[model samples]
Target: MRLDGARVLVAGATGVLGGALTAELAGRGARPALAGRDPARLARAAEAHPGAPTAVFDAYDPASCARAVHDAAAALGGLDAVVTAFGTVAFGRAAEVGDEVAEHLSAVNALAPAAFLRAALTVMGPGSVIAAFTGVVAEHPQAGMADYSASKAALSAWLRAVRREARGSGIRVLEARPGHLETGFADRPVAGTAPPLPPGGDPRRVVAALADAMEADAELLRTAPDGTPVVERRAR
Candidate 1:
């Protein structure tokens, strides 16, 4: 679990939380490979962190996801930790949201990470840590966030099942559910779907907690400002 010189891959590297997390991982002596859908943004991040590997990946494409993981592991010589941080929130009533948008959001939010984790575990040996970020809304439903919440909830469910399967493999599976963060996600364009989050959410704290949990090999329920877990361990 020690991050010192650990080889790590962070998906959604251009995203608000992902950006902060990449920095934190690098600071901890982990060689972080950046992956995103945007070539320009990926190039920028790579330029900012010279010697770091970059991979172009679309979360919806399982082939691309597998390839990226393979290449990143190769580039870094080996992979120790893989962080699946790709996310999308489409704000609206579930019925009001179009089918296409709903499917896309679901794919990005839930299916993407699920597929990524599967691919990662296939190639990743023991002592590898896999971290995926879910949302607080997965636990507490919101009227305008029905689709978003369901997608995150599905992701949480998927992680829990995988955790049980991977328990004996010595491969750690972690789920981090962070609440409203100040990272301007509320302002960006998410394919004309949900709006970004409001300001004042601390990205640093979320990333810090995630880092600590990963290093300590602890399963966590990361929260927002109020210290409430939007996500928790599901009851048997």
Candidate 2:
């Protein structure tokens, strides 16, 4: 989809990566409507782009996720893209993590994004793009992050299926499954401490690559083993 003047709604605009992406999208001439769980942070995030619309949603409430999408669509007059860049993380052995933590991870990481994109589909037409950030853990689950990985994998699987269904309508589903990023995400896990990790890939480069992928109508964006961003034109 064309970024120039495209009306885009970025869920999780309050996050580090999300904030950077919102800035990048705005710089590329896309009009961005910011959405987050916090009204105050949402307001602060919108300050970067004066008059950019903002919506609030609670990830735990699926209805709020859909409402955020509709609210942004209405505020923007229409939407050309909807991107979900928010998720929660937990670090613990599969057996040690509590059911409550597992539920929270699934709600925020999987169901919430699905809710946002499902709502976007009704308002968006052909040529509109829908994207989400699913991490490498989705495909390569780590021992300490079982539930987190499962949640991401679930979303990834859902996206894969929806891509096939949406293909005939010309809607693009871009799944960004990049490796660990230098965004301090691991340091803020909701459960057990993060294990020793190598230096992370550059998130800014990933952000730029994501914009390129969207413009090129690419289906996947991932990080190479050497920390470089790579875009796959067609997803296998």
Question: For residues 40-131, what per-residue lDDT tens digits would candidate 2 score against the true structure?
Answer: 99899999999898889998888998898888889999999999999989998899999999999999999999999999989999999999
TM-score to native of every candidate shown: 0.91, 0.99
Q: List the residue pairs that clash in candidate 1.
A: 91-194, 181-201, 182-201, 185-196, 185-197, 186-196, 186-197
Off by over 4 Å in 2: none
lDDT of 1: 0.80
Per-residue alpha-carbon lDDT of model 1 for 98-173, expressed as tens digits?
8887788788988888877788898787888888998777788777877778888998888888888988998988
Which residue window of length 10 is worst by lDDT in model 2? Answer: 60-69
